[model samples]
Target: MQTNYFYRIYLLLVIFVNAGATVDSNEQSNVGVKVFGPGWDNPQLIFPSRYFFVQHFSDKRVVRVEIEGKVGENVAANRKDCRIWTQVFNETNFDFDMIIVRYKLMSDRCSNGVIIKLFDANNELLMKKETSTAIYAEECVCHNLRWNELMNCDQNSEIYNQLFADLRTFNNSKFNFENSLEEMKRRYAPYTKSYSFCHYAIVNNEIYRKCYGEYVGFAQFMDDMLISLASKTRLPNTQLIVNLGDWPLSDTRRGSIAMPVFSWCGSDETFDIVLPTYEITESVLNMQGRVSLDILSIFGRQNGLPFNKKTSKLFWRGRDSNRLRLKLVDLSKKHPKLIDAALTNFFFFRDEIEKYGPSVSYTSFTDFFNYKYQINVDGTVAAYRMPMLMAGTSLLLKPVSKYYEHFYHLLRKNVHYILVDQELDELLPILRHLIRGKQYSAKKDELPASDEEQAAIVHNMRKFVLKYLLPSHIYCYYHKAIVEYSSLLKDGEIKVSKEMQLVYTAKSKKCNCNKNDANKDEL
Candidate 1:
């Protein structure tokens, strides 16, 4: 009996030793942790099946999605081509800081790319952009920009360091502007004399700041009273203001809504005001308000400045999203001298057999800015390039767009952008008008004349962007808007859902503000 007991104890000890050894082996096999999150040094223990978001993001509002397949099963599914799956998450109520997704790429080569499509709570498609998963075949497949360290701007990241410096400077200084309200109104006024936009907050019965963001079509003959209220926000108030840097989730969310749109929307509970894209929806500022010029792309290359050498022909390059652009291509093919429109990525238009060309290699902003006349069109909603185009040396020509940015309200038809039809039926006629009017020539590499009407228009746009589109000015606008919106809320506080607490930061958040602040010098 004693011998039997000893034998049993020995068997149990052997099993425990084996289990410990297996765990050690698993830990030793882990790799590729520094490539992901806040830790920047932790090893990732990747198993075959489960998806893993970085620790920094996963700790916040992002949640890893669970797939109903093993590594082997996922491999089998993706063997043919890229298999895209759209999962519907409740983006409306959750104030998640970020949304990170990881999946298995059943492929031997790591160069394959995966596309993720986001949908609102109602199963409406929002936007679809592709991401590279070249490292997927190595460790894990993840959307690099989604829920990674790139989105988080903390002290650890250079972006965060810069932001912190800005915050420090902002917090250190007392709110002071050299220009009075009336002076600022005049100084920052847009090019069109009729340009009018007001932003104030309404509290109880009185008005604080007087507007959230105003849309004015006609000239504002009246001036805003510059009565300054407390700009510092208090947190205890049930009502808060939120600024969203994206368009809304769906058009269906009629009244006030709380949505989760990646990083642009802050924690649902953090702010009372939210920014996103909205056509008719009331009570939200569009992200376009905070959009900034990519300083690197604009300044890195030698561009055709105003009064410099440029082609007289109108130039435009973009993906085929609207029929108008495709029509533009068709029209341009007929008049190559006047219009220079070409497709860079033709994956979508593969089936359109009518339009085919040898892919031309061209740089982005440098190529577009080289033309005296620039064409603007909407892709999905408001095109982001319009502001940059307006800032360019080119004379603006665009279709009458139903969509508009926050700044578009102040823009006049001829002064800001020449409006055209979406069908571009009059595109050729407009080019003819330019040619006949001697505004531009239909010759390659021919620059516009100094005395041309188009040249004057180009001058106004460049001046407006250089003067009013400063990063400091934009941040002040955003900060003031938030202050006004928050104080406007009453006891009837629209409670942000729990999920709205997720931390999400917009890509332009850092750039939209003081990119050239003195605080950055300290870093």
Candidate 2:
């Protein structure tokens, strides 16, 4: 009885001490632990992780951080993938309240922790925090909070350079955000032009959109993507002018600011920013109620035949968007054994239905991998389905075209895909060479890639898809491009125009930190 009484008294004393203790304000905020790579077998083992928390005050003060780290010297010397940077703000620092992370590369060894130093708006050191770098392996995998694949880290940087090349070239002249927007409105005004463009503003983590014409769910999908991004990290206040049409927008004669588009061509005097098509984004992520092509899903959920098991003949089935597609159908009809090309629907060539129709039955995207060769041709601008085709096990035969997507430049000829002539004059000869292993002369006499070479190309293409074309990478690319565009802005706060309808706002939602604990501690 005496021992029990003492134990009860001790327990009360411990509780009283903890209640009376002054807790740090930062500690009060629930900075959730983020795991980067695959979960460890041992529960006790710490994997690549980042502990993130933010405390938002009524005043709306901000601080941006750039978490930089390096791998071994040997790795750093030979490769551009040596260092990893979370988000890079210029040396000239201003007040930033939120943390935004972008993916780079690192080593597998976690022994050397990353060095973290906080700096104020004036570039003065405010605080220094050291954390283990072990959690940031080179093969570090993350579903969100940025993502990196097993491939070399430099690919991300290279793609970024290509995507923003036009922006950098145009940056020579100081950019006026308000004036450029007005110029875009005038240039593509609904009354003046047949096509319409949409305006979007991300102000203080909220998305606001105004479409001049029917977007056909483009604006909604984009809004969903932005919402997903903002839920993870706070974004800078900026505005975007997006072209909703199939073709790209250009003002080459007048030198207007580049507008973001789904695709572009190499031959055009175009300086437009190429963004991932909503179709591709929807295939990778959720598109709400819309019919998802869900092509990329073949990698996991869908059933697709293996490369060797697939038929040797080339296969293609799509709407008749270009004359080349119609020619392809004719060629397939002539050589039914070697090719199986058909128009699923005749829109552009409805008059020629007698020649190309009746339309063939719809083939599931997953069944695209049932053949050894898949032909990818341009539809409208660039074929948005290229990524989906590449993700499959079959070899992608891409005819040369002026049109290109954001990642089109990264695809190597005879490496990632087989490059055919623009006119496809030698397609039969090339196909015969690949199928029968017999050389045939054409416009330019070239031998078809060997069977081994074909396999290697498919392997390379799939690797590229896993490394760079995942939904996470798509989101990362969008966020990074927006940040770069925001940097070029020379104006103050962008306000919603009278025409734009209010779409979304994060102001209604509270900061994703432990508010109750933080407030209690503050009191």
Q: Cα-based RMSD of the predictions, in order?
A: 23.0, 19.3
- Residue-wise C-alpha lDDT for candidate 2, range 406-511, written one tens digit per residue: 7887888877888889888878888888887776655234443465556656766765765567554576677777777778777677887776666655443333
Q: What is the C-alpha lDDT of each candidate?
A: 0.37, 0.57
At residue 141, what lDDT does model 1 achieve? 21
Model 1, position 54, has a per-residue lDDT of 21
Cα shift from native, residue 186, model 2 (Å): 2.1
Q: Supply the global lDDT for candidate 1.
A: 0.37
The candidate that wins on lDDT is 2
